[model samples]
Target chain A: MIAPLLQGFLDEFERLEAAMPGYEQAWLRQLRRDRLDAFVTSGLPGRREEAWKYTPLKGLEQRAFALPRGSALPPPLPPPLDAVRHRLVFVDGRFAPESSRLPADAEIEFLPLSEVFRNHDAAARFRIARLMGSGEDALDHLNAALATDGLLLRVPAGRSVREPVHLVYLGSKQSSGRAWHLRGLIELEGGARLRIVEHFYDGGEEAELSSVINEIQLAADAELELVRFQDMGARSILLSRTRLQVEARGRLRITAIDRGGELVRSEWLTTLRGREAHGDIAGVARLRGRQHADQVVEVRHLERDTSAEVRFRGVAEDQSRAVFTGTLHVAPGASGAETRLSSRNLLLSPQAEVDTRPVLEIHHDEVVAAHGATVGQLDPEALFYLRSRGFSETMARAILIGAFLEEISIRLPEPRFAEWVSSRMGLDHPLPWGGEKT
Target chain B: MLEIVDLHVSVGGTPILKGLDLRVPRGEVHAIMGPNGAGKSTLAYVLAGKEGYERTRGDIRWDGKDLLSLAPEQRAIAGIFLAFQYPVEIPGVNNAYFLRTAVNLKRKARGEPELDAVEFLRAARERLRLIGSDDGLLQRGLNEGFSGGEKKRNEILQMLMLEPELAILDETDSGLDIDALRLVASGVNALRSPERAFLVITHYQRLLEHIVPDRVHVLAEGRIVASGGPDLAQRLEREGYGWLAERRRASEALG
Candidate 1:
């Protein structure tokens, strides 16, 4: 009974495969085959996997989702990044030329993969062939198999782009119930620096199942800052994954502000492949009305003198659920590895739930690794103190939650992004630390 | 003015304040001196509207208003402030931002315009300097990682920001050194006004020496056992509560 239906699901997917732009290219054909064959064996990951135990995928099942027809007109992207002149827009996971405004600069290679390959850049032409088939993440494999169009960005050695590059992925109303996969590639060479912002939107009422995979490669002494804002609509399901390889003296700072959907799973997988590399990751989540959000972070320190720090704040209200799982694995010989993980959560109602797991598997004695997590209500005393200062109960709660989330704000590479996050979380109280002058 | 008549309070089904009676006119600093288990902290908690402290029978009138009928924040807006004995440390909340929010909320409740960040920063800097503190404490978390004295000074900073009409200092001088004691005392003295009242609860006469009270009352076994001038605190300091407890027992027996 199940075999025929599985075959049908794959046959229906062939319709989407036919509509892809670069479906006939020999290199892309080989890449898709490599990823799809692996995905076919295991199927979609389920709750049995240790890393996927808390994420339920019912919202993504039982329905046929096809590729969407791009709309002639779509709503403008949400700001403070809307005014960003260097934005590249993608509708239904395909580059939309009408909606994007691209600027050219000598230091940046911000364009599509087809354009980069046409320009005969050897480094750009071999990216997918080199990095696509190596990851074990099931979602990454699925995205690589389905994706046909996405942005490719590169920063040459010793050059820094003055303006931040922005990428906006708009899910059109016509894209309802369509499962799309978007893939992005970013590479930074030695002593290069850049900042990128990625935004995702679910533009319709019907459920949209989507997956995104970002592959990043950083050379020695490289630096990159990335901020991601995701709201997959009220009924959408998203599997977003980011994988990075950092060399010696490379730094990667990332912040994720997530207001999740019916089902959303966001993962960060990083490997410190060289000495003196560092990764700092922070995120804040607000979930309500039976929504489910899961954040997973894994850092592998394979070399000496590597460090990583992760801090997450979550608030779940109205029968919602939130999960934060982090793992810092220091190999036996990776001495001088310093890693820290902290997660704080507030459950507004007794029905709301938060599960936090900060695991440390350190095999070396010369490393400093610690994990601290707390799941509780607002401090009764602090709540009383704030209320005793003339703030109403609702306002008091908002202020404390804002203050709790302020930890992520101070560490933002673009501090102005804090305002957008505070308002997005429905916490408009006066921030504990006043907004900066800028 | 503040008045409490036959106040009876309980906590977790256990009686804490039993039939306590007290009154203070406006512009008077009245100190409640008592030993351990005398319900000194209970009095402050009840007046501040802390949960779990049930008022079984009581009538508390603050400035011609029924205080027990109001919520904690309403009581705050109506000019009642309790400087906590142990100020809580709330990480990630900046001290200056916390105070400014409190002040602006109170002002908004009273039909006043709000102050922007610049205006609030300037005003808080003045108050910080007046309290003999610096901006470093303001930049840090609200009482987070602060020393004992620094915590007490932060309480005073809030008081200075809100400028409440009635202030209850709950053992504000308990763990302070001599310098902190003088600083806190001076900060309290600076807020003395014709329309204000003070209920300073202390276990020692040392604080009274710095800010002399107009009257001193002795509390024991959940009631005001005796009342007199500042000399009473000094006498209680010199000679403990044994004599007062014996006299109260004899009076109860005779009655």
Candidate 2:
């Protein structure tokens, strides 16, 4: 009675079990089997699920995908960041030791997930068992079962890394119609600081799908800044979920930029576990053609004096659709919690659509929360003003769209990354000042 | 010359300008002094080709060319500029960049070479210096966070840079203090020449006192009810338009 797609996945898991990491560990084997069983029982999300209403998976359910086989050469990489010296590169969902530049620092543990499991690191296995499959849907369970390779990063207590660590996940040309499930774990000890830049790209232009699950834990007084950029092929689909827990006096800053892929769904779930924990999340999605992007964020204030802010800006044109749903919750007795959530979208064409929903469930009356969502066309007054100043309608619209997204792009971790984001959105027209000639 | 014949414009199905006619030959400044709701601002918007201002029946000719058929940018390229009463704030757009873009666009349309950044900035800085203003405004966002008087002054700053053939000032002195009023007037006077004409629209005659007009016209009921020399502006300032309304009512009764 099992679906054919589910049967195919099960068969693949059985065949690849010996080749997977931690194959000798009986506990990990049982753990993967239990999660796979859970996936089989639930299957792909259907139309009835409220969270999956906007993003349908019926098409994805009919297709069968297997793990990427063998190593393949990565496509041309993006230019290196000036401030980033430590690099980790993955090609075709497999770690590329040839392309990686490992860190020489002793205070940081930077290694592949396969190494962590193959070496039988008990500390990592414990955290992985505790944090995996924590999502509200079955996708996380699927990732937990099928994940083969990812990054495992840990910073010792009282240590700060001034230079950022870059992780590049590339779907090379040989990865067409292949799927990769990547799981990452990041642990920051008390008073430790670290910055990470994660980049995802499909160089082959025919990748089928990629699912990434990252679990982040920050201890007391820890600080972490994570920036992720996703630019996949037009035929590919990307599903990602990041679950984070911030303890007392911890600070977490995250920025997610989605610019490519036919379909993308990004979810960030954060729980403030201790007092004065703060989370700042900002995202931008620029989509055109028939592309679709959905971002869901939920921040829970479980302790007093915790604060969080989630802001997103989306620009959809040419029949593309962008969706943002934010939920801010204040647990009972978390009276001093404060939160701000906003999603503003611009529909550039008649066929373009955007849906934004901001929900605030404040259990405590003393908490201050402000949330707003707006979907509108460009300001007609501003448009007319620009036209009256001799700018063509196209140029005028581009300028206004650039201005709309400037607030978020300017804060990118790297200064040049802002330029890259603007160029990807086609907003990098030569200006009178910075540009030599127009 | 700029010529308008029997212009009729309506906004959102309500008529604002009905059967209006005017002409401004080159080498002259005309002041339009009218009461509120007399289509003074509407005339400026219509001339600049703003959308939603339906020109049901009108012929706007600029140097014998049909103007209404052209788009707003086309009109702007043809040397028409309107200083807004409430200048719009364009956040994230640098003032100098915007001014330079507009200037270069006009120049390119006219088959003239565009100025580079250095040349453009030098010219702009000179203009600011001549107007007794600083260069700080050029670095900020266009009209963003500007005070009331500063917004009006910024409009004049734009006019100075654009150097349009037909400049329309729509209540450009409403919220300006005397000092700002004088600075804006000087900025305008600096651009005055035989090859350009100005249409200054205002509710009060204070701006006219600084940039004395060659001709003054009183607009009422969407038509030019009276036109005379500079003395007419002084007369309206003293009489407060009471006699003009009485005269209009008398004419209506006769009809």
Candidate 3:
């Protein structure tokens, strides 16, 4: 029997397909059908799944979510970022054309993804397929069948975008009991450089759940710096999948910040397909209350001379739990590749839990790979050391935990941006002493 | 201004400090020189109120108040300081920020205003320069990846910044080079005042030559066996703990 949690999705899929625009192409329809069938067969991951054993989705088992509609012109909320220019806003799964803006020296292309699918003929379908990954999972199928609107960016060859692009997803009041599927397609041509900041925020109780799949492709010698900040409310659930492929000598760096959620799981996979490519991924999560967060990452080095560094830092307080797992694998041909993974977690409460695992699988003996994982509470010696210097117990613990998370925060490409993200989520408190909330 | 009377401390299941009694008056720097496992570190940990140390029988007073009743941080604000025998490496905590929080907390407890980051930085930078420390050292994690001498020096730097009335130096000169020992001892000497006191716990007499204590106490088997002037530390240096061990054996036999 199909799990009741996923049964409603089949009906929702039928409704979305009936209302969605531009299915004149039989190929796209077939692709969506296959994905839906795959989800029906495999179903949502259960407690028995080794990767999801610690975090269960019991709350989502009995809920039903429908797609929320968006407006062509929507009122603007206060911009979360101060220094960054050119932001593409999507509220309630629909791109807000009026709320979006582009730079004056805009040499790149930025268009609504729905518009691309609508205008592209059968011949142009190759681009769509390239952006759509294997499309193999429940959310992947859901995203394939029901994605409403997204931002499509194309940076030309040999040109670098100086200003960072902000992909802001806002959940509106009408989004209650609604789940949105968002897909972003980003392509950086050969030798091109671009930085994209993907931001996800639930306005309040109205927006409850969302699934996002972002596709990023870097060409030869191209460089892409992407940062993701998820600051959803405690009542919200968000699942995000970010996948990227780097060509020869291309560099891709992603820094993700998760500031608590009712349930949050982020899957990040990167493939280094060319020689001398570098992949650097770092994420930090600060969970409190009954919130839960999971970060799963996989890095594949398929070519020689590739290097990747992955690190995750997490803090769980109250009755919350945080899980982080990183896997690095080097193919036989990628003999000269080097990879390193580090996952560090701090559990602030006895009820809180953290699971960290770092795995390295190397098919080539010539490659250098190392991984380390640690899960522990605040060091008592460190705590006493701070207290001996007159820091109160709470202040001492905050300093140590915040500092532990700073390993990821300090390395953000934008320091002010990092601070903004932290302060908004109550994760970054620079004060030596703070209220009981910290 | 610090007094420890009939101090008894136990670690795990065994007693480490048994009936240790000592009085360090104001305007004096007392030296505690003992051999390995002589409870020198235990005494410091017990006085600082470190957890896991059970004090079954002890009374410690600082500045006419019951210091043992206070928490570790409370005792700190009450003008009691312990330069740890092995300073802990606090990963990710900023050194400068840590020192400032310490100074400001003590100040707040004493009914003084807390310094802002700018003011704290100015004050800390001045003290850091006075102690010949790299200004950038604070930018890194507190005592993380610090060299042996640097860690000891960092302890002294905190001591200098906090200016505790009664400071306990627990083997602060153990891993130091001759130069580091001189710098740390000088830092301590510079903080000496008629209204303040110090309890320097060390295993070597080389530190005494730098700070020149007012009195030296020899602790053997968890209790003070002898108390004398600086000449005692000089003798402990010339001749190791062999003489003290023999004296303790003879005293036990006579008893």
Best by TM-score: 2
Candidate ordering by lDDT (highest first): 2, 1, 3
Show where candidate 2 strays beyond 4 Å: A80-84, A103-107, A127-136, A173-175, A204-207, A429-438, B108-118, B242-255
Candidate 3, residue A41: the lDDT equals 74
lDDT of 1 by residue, A117-161 (tens): 335345655775664565665576777777766778789999987
Clashes of each: 0, 0, 0
Distance from true location, Cα of B169 in model 3, Å: 1.0
Lowest-scoring 10 consecutive residues by lDDT in candidate 1 chain B?
B92-101
- Give the poorly placed runs of model 3, Cα more than 4 Å off: A1-4, A10-19, A23-38, A48-59, A70-80, A121-125, A129-134, A173-175, A205-207, A348-350, A359-361, A364-366, A424-438, B116-122, B125-139, B235-255
What tens-digit string does per-residue lDDT give for candidate 3 at A108-214?
89878788777885645677765554567667876776675676789999998988888888777454677777887889999999988878776666537788888
Report the CAPRI category for model 3: acceptable
Worst 10 residues of 3 chain A by lDDT: A429-438
Report the Cα lDDT for residue A262, model 1.
76
Q: Compared with the true structure, what per-residue lDDT tens digits does model 1 show for residues B1-255?
A: 899999999999899999999998889999999989999999998999988899999889997799999999999999899999988888867677778778888899899998887888887778778768987888787889999999999899889889999999999999999988998999999888888899999999999999999999999999999999999999999999999988988998999
**What lDDT does candidate 2 reach at residue A339?**
98
Per-model TM-score, in order, reads 0.92, 0.92, 0.90
- Candidate 2 residue-wise lDDT at B154: 81
TM-score, chain B only, every model? 0.97, 0.97, 0.96
Give the Å error, residue B49, model 1: 1.1
Which DockQ-derived CAPRI band holds candidate 1? acceptable
